[model samples]
Target: MDERLSVAPVVPRFAAAIREVAAVTAFYAGGSIGSGDYRPGISDLDLVAVIAAPLTRARRDRLRSLHRTLGVAKLHCAYVSLPDISDVSRKHVNWAHERMFRRPLSGISRAELHQFGVTVYGPSPAELVPQIGREELATAARAELRGYWTGAVRRARVWRTDLHVDLGLTTVSRAGVTIETGRLITKREAIDRLPALGVPDDLTDEIRRRRAGEPVELTEPQIRARAVVARALMREQLTRLLG
Candidate 1:
């Protein structure tokens, strides 16, 4: 890949909504889409900015422009207020993000995000993460790998098999999790490692259920239930990559 083509910082054209968000915000981290390693057909200009307040019109506009200029890699971005940094829900969001985006633009980094993880809703900035221990991380990796494999299986039903393949590839590649076979490992090989991390059989069942298009199903009102399943699966996959 030519360095010129790599996500060089371009002045983003944004709407007033996006500009408002960018101007007032104290960005923790963000940069060119797909600031990390490059993979064919799998890159996006992603941004993660932490602000002190809700985004305004200009902010939203700029975000869109940033993506458009960044090209087909699809621009992914997140905006969170400083207070939102410590919120539980926000923490979960950040936790999930860590798996998918460990490396950021050259100027942006994940260290700050991880710092937020250890001090959710707390004042201390120096507190060490006793919970995100080695064992915990290892467990997370296994679960996440399972998530990637299972997600691949289920998404294959709704989307094309190639998309599922791309999902697994993108997730793993983004997470920077090393696999001896790179991206070509078989499905069984992928699932085999997940149980060691404490992922329940129920998850596998759900993946299978969705893939099989089972008769027993939840209605639209039960969307929350559906999300729960997806979230769990995401956790497993994200954890594997980011953990």
Candidate 2:
């Protein structure tokens, strides 16, 4: 590995955590530490591991423990199986997989995994896998933000300062439909564009109020109602754009 590739200091520690997972038969792809292939504002560690199946209770517990330890600021980890790559479906996964070789520390080479096409690490693949489209996935992601925003609104009303801000950014990113250079519009700019996407006037108002340091709280019922609408709109846009 190149000295530059060893940039992510948490690689060794993360690999150790994977080992504690019990059934993980093999591990690879540890070097893409700071790669922009995932989401923005994700300053956490993202890793992929191949595991051996029949996960024991102890193994699950170990994963939870690892989560508690790594949850500290500046460190986060997400584990996925090899076959799950196919489920991501987006062309970006191919691009991301290819870029793995450029990272500072890689247990798995970009070429090796792709050449094999689909590699199975454990007895079987993980139960849940991320399935999405390049176009549709973006829309679906935005819907999540919309739901979070509603929650942010309620949290603000209740003076839940921490959650309000957290969900505020999340909501804007989801409901904002403008895609600039292949990204959702910036949170600052999304406000202006929400109306065009048919977002309700009140939701936008709440977002603005929160930005201005107002207390807003969106109840669970309110969030669910908005999420239903947001999901429908996102699917509509994605269908048109993706087609």
Candidate 3:
């Protein structure tokens, strides 16, 4: 483990705890952890564990208990079976936000696995997961903007929350760059580019400060006003890219 990586201690502790319940063969760390832009409390520890076999009911129960005991919020992992590694759309057991659920292994995740995945305790991601091309990444970006974000803009209430305002806008920045250049940028970079996307400087500054683990407070009306601007910006960007 490199000392420079912010989540270095988390990798081994999580890997050991996960192996206690499942036969995790190839353990990998991706997203901010792999991209070298991890902010200790702000970023999520996105991980992947390739199991030797499909998890049994008993094993899933044990894994669920383990996550509860670990109590590390934002530490999420997709437990993928070896046989299911190649299929990006295949639904697999996942642990996120301290809850066990099932979701398809997304194309963006696979792309990150291939591009900057860190092999923590097994063979390289390239040996287990197939390489994801740039075009596929671009397509996935467009689909997300067209799909989830389209609905998010329609919902006025969700934008008022800090998590939604920050993540939603940053995602648009990231998706737009990926759509145009087929490249991934860290959240830090995305924040810097928010102004280029027509986001107000003060709002971007607040986002940056909050991401740095500083305290930020906003009144109800202020939050709602920012939310309105964010939604319109998202809608305009969606039209620019998708149209």
Question: Number of clashes in every candidate structure?
Answer: 27, 16, 0
lDDT of 2 at 199: 60
Best by TM-score: 3
Per-residue accuracy of model 1 over 203-230 as CA lDDT, tens digit each: 4454334333454444564444444444
Q: Give the better candidate number (2 or 3) by lDDT.
A: 3
Error of 1 at 73 (Å): 5.8
- Candidate 1 segments whose C-alpha is farther than 4 A from its true place: 1-6, 11-19, 28-36, 39-42, 56-73, 91-152, 155-160, 169-243
Best by lDDT: 3
Off by over 4 Å in 2: 1-7, 20-42, 46-54, 65-74, 82-132, 158-163, 170-243
Question: Residue 179 of model 1: what lDDT?
Answer: 35
What would you estimate as the lDDT of candidate 1? 0.37
Point out where model 3 deviates above 4 Å: 4-8
Model 3: per-residue Cα lDDT over 1-243, one tens digit each: 645344568777889888858999988888987888788878888999999998999999999988888788788899999998888788999999779999877888888888768887889988889877888888888887776888888999898888888998998999889889988888899999999999999999999999899999999889889999988998898888888
Residue 214 CA error for candidate 1 (Å)? 38
Query: Relative to the unseen true structure, what is the C-alpha lDDT of residue 109 in candidate 1, on a scale of 0 to 100?
Result: 28
lDDT of 2 by residue, 1-243 (tens): 323225454555556656656445544432123222222233333444554443355765666566565654434333343443443322211113112111111212222223221222332222323323335535455444443433443332432333343344334443334222334333445555656666677866776666446777778787666555555544454444334
- The lDDT, on a scale of 0 to 1, for candidate 2 is 0.42
- Between the candidate structures 1 and 2, which one is better when assessed by lDDT? 2
